[model samples]
Target: MADNATSNRKRCSLNAFISHAANTTDVVPEFPARNGPQRLVAAATKQPKRRQKVILEPGHSALDWARLKSSGKDLRGVPQLGRYTLTEIKEHRTENDAWTALNGKVYNMTSYVKFHPGGVKDVMRIAGRDGTKLFMLTHSWVNFEFMLDACLVGFLVPE
Candidate 1:
């Protein structure tokens, strides 16, 4: 349902193939290198060996989470979005009803438990607490705002 101009990917070929000819001819990159072509391969030594992620269950992938978020489901456990105090958020620390404050915004993380790559227990470590510091210390590169936008309950309020 997206326009060709707005789409990030280019549609060059009507036929999909795996041969070298198909890749070299059909796959036309949007940005061509100024200094001829560059190799797509990367050095093995440059690749990272490990990360904090664990194997996610079927249908719990990051892409699955993105789809679920766009499904119009109310992931937030609360009846409506409202400023929540620490005590109020603390009451929702259970696995079935978890909440956390990050960067002053409160997000209902109950729906995100299975989608969390760090495992359920790791996410529960900050349940009912402000996890900005811990989240920064662990995975600062993650954009929580965009990831958990659909699960946004409200803003964190002073207790």
Candidate 2:
């Protein structure tokens, strides 16, 4: 009887100790007091650091031909011969002489028509017309300016 009671007491004590330890093990410590240099260091470490400002070197402007020509200054001696009106652009609508107007620029796409990823028919459909909307709709992500840079015949003059 006495031994049974002692065993029960030991079991109860062990259970109580285990419960207390479980509770303590799961608890997170409170943050350190907020007035010291430790707190400042903690706060600083928690925040994201400001990134250094990137100083990019001046590079080529893709579509800003006016700026490029003006900056060169000596471009005045280079006689510009290929400015075309809409009527003139319309004259070159065949596959052999395919010209396309996109974003106020005229591109002679005769050679490019054969190599078009979408098909020559797509290029032919927009020949000699302002295909800006269709071009953006079909290939808004394509860098047409860069791709057609070499094919650029001239700027489109107003009707």
Among these predicted structures, which one has the highest lDDT?
Answer: 1
Clash count, one per candidate? 0, 0
Worst 10 residues of 1 by lDDT: 36-45
Candidate 1 has what TM-score? 0.66
TM-score of each: 0.66, 0.49
Mark the 10 consecutive residues where model 2 has the least summed lDDT: 54-63
lDDT of 2 by residue, 1-159 (tens): 999999999999999999998888575655675677778787678676574443333342333433553354432221554777889888888888888788988887775665665556766888877778899987899888877766677888887
Error of 1 at 39 (Å): 37
Give the Cα lDDT of each candidate: 0.84, 0.71
Cα misplacement distance, residue 36 of candidate 2 (Å): 65
